[model samples]
Target chain A: MADFEPTIVAFCCHYCAYGAADLAGSMRLEYPTNIRVIRLPCTGKITPVFLLRAFEKGADGVYVAGCLEGDCHFIQGNLVAKPRVNYTKKLIQEVGLEPERLEMFNMSAAMGPRFAEVAREFTERIKNLGPSPLNKKNRNKTDKAA
Target chain B: MVIGERKPFDEIMRMAEGLKKIMVLGCGGCVTVCLTGGHDEVRVLSSQLRMARDKAGNPIEIIEKTIERQCDPEYVDQVESIVPEVDAVFSMACGAGVQFMAEKYTGKPVYPSLNTTFVGGSKKEGYYVERCQTCGECKLYYTGGICPIARCSKSLLNGPCGGSTKGKCEIDPDVDCAWQLIIDRLKSLGMMDRYEDIMPANDWRTNRDGGPRKMIREDFQR
Candidate 1:
């Protein structure tokens, strides 16, 4: 488990989490390279299919990072995505995977350090769980893309 | 609308043990409206099944296609060209759709992905409740549009049946007493006289007791 470098997918809202990641880079914040960020217009657009497909595609961990509560770019995109995240967690559990493999986090666009912190934290969580049973034959392919 | 809920993934996987290739047929009817077996659901369920099969060292190739309505032969025929390519069919529609698929392709094994729940609709976004029993009888004019047959626990004709309390059914506190609703509705409409008339016994012959029934439109057929 210590040597396992998990392929963690972070689905981020453009107005907040994605901007936070950019800020994190500008700040030169050091986070694990294992985390891959997928920028979305809003977390509310995140569907159960997207989360499930991530697991089916062999993601060790998947998390949706959106705007802080009541601070959404589109009024209540974060709140809209909350129940969907919870619903997808149950779905992944149905497939014999740990529900902890998927998570949702909220942060403002200004929180660069929090973005990097979340990256490291989720990576550590996935590392503890080891590689997903459905891990691709060539796991390192995603390493370069991120 | 016919409400359908997907069966457990394990049960579906168990039935899919020997399948190599399949077509996930989705219905664009009641199941779609109910948010169960639609286009997106076919993909989701197919993806899940593919992953589970892959993990178990048995890979399955899935061809996904959703039709207008699985209950109609016109739509079911749309899959004719591709259906022959797959060994079996994994239907994501209701039991009727699944059975229709089975009947159409007697050679291929057809599997149902959902358990057909009831004839119902939802006032709530995600919660659906039954509203009809299809008893081949119409009595809504007298019951103030509230159906005691489907809503009542006992399906009594002269209900309230000494079990209703606090305007709720004795079976479940959450269930509203159908007869109580009828009484209240009739009273509000100044038509309490409708309830005063003693109801006669229902003819079981008109119900499913008469066996499988059909409607023939002689003009349309000709």
Candidate 2:
């Protein structure tokens, strides 16, 4: 378990979080390598199903990063995402997983440092929670076969 | 226009106990219009149930399908081939759809995922309030188009009960005094004279107080 490498998924909005990731790359900011970013047009495109699907498919931790509050490029897209993320938290808890495994964050496109910091913070959080039970179960099955 | 809401998550899991593979059937009718049970909802519920089962280490195989309308036999017939594959049918439709699916497949178990609520229209998105009880009789002409049988807590046809207070029912502050709404509507329509006529006692024989009711269109029948 000490050697476990958590697989994280970050649903980044193209206008902000994705651009921030691009800037993070340009600035050469160091963030954890656990994140696998899936760029979305806007966080408003997110539904509870998408987050639920991530955990079902074995993502150890998932976070949606959109534009800061009222600064959404498409007006209130970021505002629309907060509740869906919160609702998905309850859903994961219902599935017997920690609600902390999923989250939502907001930042402008220029906040590359914040993006890196968020990635590192979320990665560290998931690492402490350990591998998701779904993934762990798969590992156990593989070990049994071996 | 029947309204419904999903049963609690815990109740759903409890009802699904010991069931392995089951079909989650959704109706694209009233339940769908109300955002209760529809194609999107079926997927959401199926996904949730699968994750819950997986987390419990008791994984379940769920088949998801949404029919045009489960109340009709032709639509229910669409699942005849797939029905045999699952242990039971989890209907996300209202009670009628659930019973129809159950009746169509006598060998398989059928369960309702939504509590069949009332016949009503949405006040807005995701908000539903009962408007009719389908008491087999309607007196909207005298009641100013409001249904006392449904809107009134006591289903009082004559007027507001003693419990009415300042336009709200005593049952809850949120519940509007149905009779008050009726009286105001009547006054606005210049139909205040109708309010003076005391409504006669309703006939129980026309409602559920009678036995289960059925109607047949003789001309449409073979």
Candidate 3:
């Protein structure tokens, strides 16, 4: 609904979010196409460095979708990822970025509708916030060209 | 091995002022094994420093490098090429490494990002315990291989005072009495009679009390 099209990265768990994405396609549940998903073995493998790197590389919104609590295929993978998300949120905020740009969600592989719902909700949120201030370099060049 | 922790980010930024270029030196020895000054930490600190500098309107160029051992001159000599280009160096190694870097680069200022703790060993995977004082004295044979200099709260050599209650030291409720341990170990070895000999006070002159201790082998010098 707005000119700002947020560049979103979803670090999806291989066993859950990845499967759920496939289910969404199978069910024909349509969502925003701007989201790029990176499948990881488990959410625990997602370090704070990797999350910061995503933000540094022009990601307007970053989300970590892991298995439900106590339901992770790798014991406490989701649990480990939960605190790291909170830490990275604080770090991003300290660096003058909106903390809400980073989000962590838990869902099962069977929740195809929920995945689509998340995509829509997150896209709307980012659209309301407008473009990331860090991407001003690209915006300025585009504005001058126009 | 000495155990230490990284300084706060704000403090590190304050110490890094006026430097347009920085070289973050990381050690792959004790600090690396302790997870404070390893390659991973070097990258994180470099990124954070760069971001902080940029945010402060003073973008700094930083080069991240790590060595196998910072205390060894050979390992530190590897930075000869980059040391000349950087305005300053921020060492994440122990105090010895920081001093070594300062000595190596006479003109450039070298700052330390970590507080040097003491010669210790890990109690657990992530926990460390001070075990030696490097007092230039070896009395472990009589004390059942435990250094009273570090283990004892007061560095007492003969025995623990009445402050020891139920195997715990009075200084720290969580710490076990070093003298109690010495007695137990000696008893187990059927050598409790060794404790009867009146041990004299430790000679402080043998340590840093003599102003920077040093040792050399005359036979090997040639």
Question: How high is the TM-score of chain A in each model?
Answer: 0.91, 0.92, 0.92
lDDT of 3 by residue, B27-141 (tens): 9999988877888778767766755555555666788899998888999999999999998999999988899989888999999989888889887766888998888988998
On residues B46-101, what C-alpha lDDT tens digit does candidate 1 reach at each position? 87777677666667778888999998888888888888899889998999899888
Every candidate's lDDT? 0.87, 0.89, 0.84
TM per candidate: 0.95, 0.93, 0.82
Among the numbered candidates, top DockQ falls to 1
lDDT of model 1 at residue B3?
A: 95
Candidate 1: share of reference interface contacts reproduced: 0.39
Candidate 1: where is the Cα deviation over 4 Å? A135-146
DockQ of each: 0.42, 0.39, 0.22
Q: What share of the true interface contacts does each candidate keep?
A: 0.39, 0.42, 0.08
Q: Extract clashing residue pairs from model 2.
A: none
- Candidate 2, superposed: residue stretches over 4 Å from native: A135-146
TM-score of chain B of each: 0.96, 0.97, 0.94
Give the winner by lDDT: 1 or 3. 1
The parts of candidate 3 lying over 4 Å away from their true place are A1-8, A30-35, A60-63, A68-106, A113-146, B217-222
DockQ rank, highest first?
1, 2, 3
- Alpha carbon deviation, residue B128, candidate 3 (Å): 2.1
